[model samples]
Target: MNRRTLIIVTAVVAVGLFAIGGLLYSPTSKEVAVTKPVSNEAPLVRPHSPVFGAKDAPVTIVEFFDPACEACRAFHPVVKKILSEFQGKVRVVLRYTAFHPPSEEAIRILEAARLQGKFEVVLERLLETQPRWAPHGRPADSAWSLLDGTGLDVERARRDAKLPGIVAVLNQDTADVKNVGVTGTPTFFVNGKPLLDFGAQQLLDLVEAEVASN
Candidate 1:
């Protein structure tokens, strides 16, 4: 071959060898993709917390409520409305912050009802008759009567309510209440984000926004 042609041929061969080497040493296209870390949000539900909705729902709303608080009663229907609207998209986790005089007893009562698999019914009945049971000052003794037909087995509940497990649940919730800076009943959180401003409309809007984003 002529000198110039030989040099050109050598250069082409060298380039081809380099290209093949690069392909062999470099990572495959599928293996070279950047990977992002998985997000792990703080847990919103506790073992003792009461849950409403699908167990593995995308959105969680944690509510610190006082059973004796009239505002809690008022907001109960609103929360139900929001849940109904969202259906399976959201779940509510109820935590106790028993500020009222009878609120602790109410919590104990609910805990007892939970043991009997009657948590929902007793909760509904308690809220429905909160005024009568958890009135101003000392709770009226008449409150016990309201639980008669609630499938609560009031006597059993009364005994179980004082047990260590229920007491521990109440104590832990109280501590969390302080840690979370819950000043009053019906305080709400959506997806570990606190409700900065308190209002029914504000809660609904926040929930709606979370639902849309998720």
Candidate 2:
């Protein structure tokens, strides 16, 4: 090849090599940000949520509970005993995890009772009568009939159950249930720590650990 041709070929090859190097090592102008899906699982406790035991208790047991769950019914007394034992050291924040036909209606009834300052009594009554009213696949309307004259203004509660506030509460709790990975009723979270293995004793142990830590 002629000298000029040789020089031109060398220049082109050098330019190609530089371009390849630039591609290999240059900082990219276009930033591809791969964002991961963030968890929306906030605190299980909300302002409108149902709380039992001392309001100022340092430790909080957040239970993702379904009113229709027979297991939840059984755990009621055990939870009560734990609260009695913990007393001022812990409180429970109940979030609805309505996994059955009667669960949502039962929550609505309980909230209606809350509106009428009868939450505790109505909750007790419903838990006590859950077998009759919350049996598997039970229609919600039949359960509503049972709530009548419980000092809840049952007719009014049936109406109020459709109210925006109660609905929003239920919807939010349902979303939280999925977000927090709750697959069953009576799922417990002690101060944001999930009960990895579920049992009455596990719950008590977690609560005691949290209470002691606080």
Candidate 3:
């Protein structure tokens, strides 16, 4: 081959290799792991209450969930069971990620309930009746029905739902989800480490080990 032709071919090959390397090594936004505190360094707890043991417990389980998610509803019973089994040994913090319309409304109601200091009671009732209330692709009315039985004054609950402070709390939760890089519902963090592909039992086991270590 002529010298110029050979040089041109080599240049083309070099460019092709560079393009391939870039595709292979470039870091995309989705590839990044969410950074969070390893343990006690986490910031102030949000307005919502943690499930399971006392606030001062040795082990903490933080869950990011969407209320209208069927998977989340399926996990509700197991979560309650975990709280009951662990009692005072662990604490479960639930952060709302309203990924859908119904879930958004449900979160608003839950936040409103918080204003009345009945958040836990309302949450339990919602979980217990989630199937009836949170059917797939349904509207927010079912959740409202469950809230009706929370013993919170209906007028106060409605008013609080629209309160500026409660809206701010909900927005904070959304920001937390973004900061944590959570892509879906029911994501869990044990002692601040991501629990990828782990089941509820595995999660509990990790919590127990952490408690034992501490």
Candidate 4:
């Protein structure tokens, strides 16, 4: 081949290789921003949302949860398992999506428990006893009696549940649930990517992928 022709071919090959490299490159978590999917707003993590695990963890699992949801109750342990598996690398931010009529009261109980630093404990108890209180197509019989040994001050929590601050939190979470387009309980987003497949294994795999990317 002529010298000029060889040089031209080499330049073309190099350009092609560079373009292929760019196409093959996958963005890491640090390179991407986790925002609301439709509106392209800021990160979905709200300052007032109840978070589980390291507050500064690199991976975030945002769960739009309804306290009266049986699926949320079922998936509670699955989420805990993911936290246990990831340790300090992942955290869960729970937003109240109260689809059921009784869920607001249940959330009030939880938020009040949060104020008293008993969020996790109270949550476990509520879920553990959920079936008794929350039957499908009906209001929860009432969760107050179920808090018997969960270390929450029932009387004080009842009063605190009525607080304007607590009510505001509930209001904001309800608004966010609508704004974010969460139609059901236990809808999960891993680093802003929705879990469309919707299963325990799928959730675990998504978390694993995000953690590895980070």
Residue lDDT tens for model 4, 1-214: 7543443344344334434542111111111122444334233567888899999898999988888876576556567767888999999998887888778999999999999999999999988888778877556467998998888999999999999999998888888777777776577888888777655556778899999999
**Candidate rank order under TM-score:** 4, 1, 2, 3
Per-model TM-score, in order, reads 0.77, 0.76, 0.74, 0.79
1-214 per-residue lDDT for model 1 (tens digits): 7543443344344334444542111111011111221133323457778999877888888888888876677567667767877899999999998888888888888889999999999999998898788767654766567886776788888899889999899888888776565666677788877776555556778888899999
Our model 3 lands, by Cα RMSD against the true structure, at 15.5
Off by over 4 Å in 4: 1-43, 137-140
> What TM-score does structure 2 among the candidates reach?
0.76
In model 4, how large is the Cα lDDT of residue 164?
99
Best by lDDT: 4
**Model 3, poorest ten-residue lDDT window?**
22-31
Q: lDDT score of model 1?
A: 0.72
Q: TM-score of predicted model 4?
A: 0.79
Give the per-residue lDDT digits (tens) of candidate 2, residues 1-214.
7543443344344334444542111111112121222233364777888899999999888877888876666566667767888999999999998988778888998888899998988888887788788666544336676665567788788799899999999989888777666676666777777666555556778888888889
Each prediction's whole-model lDDT (CA): 0.72, 0.71, 0.65, 0.75
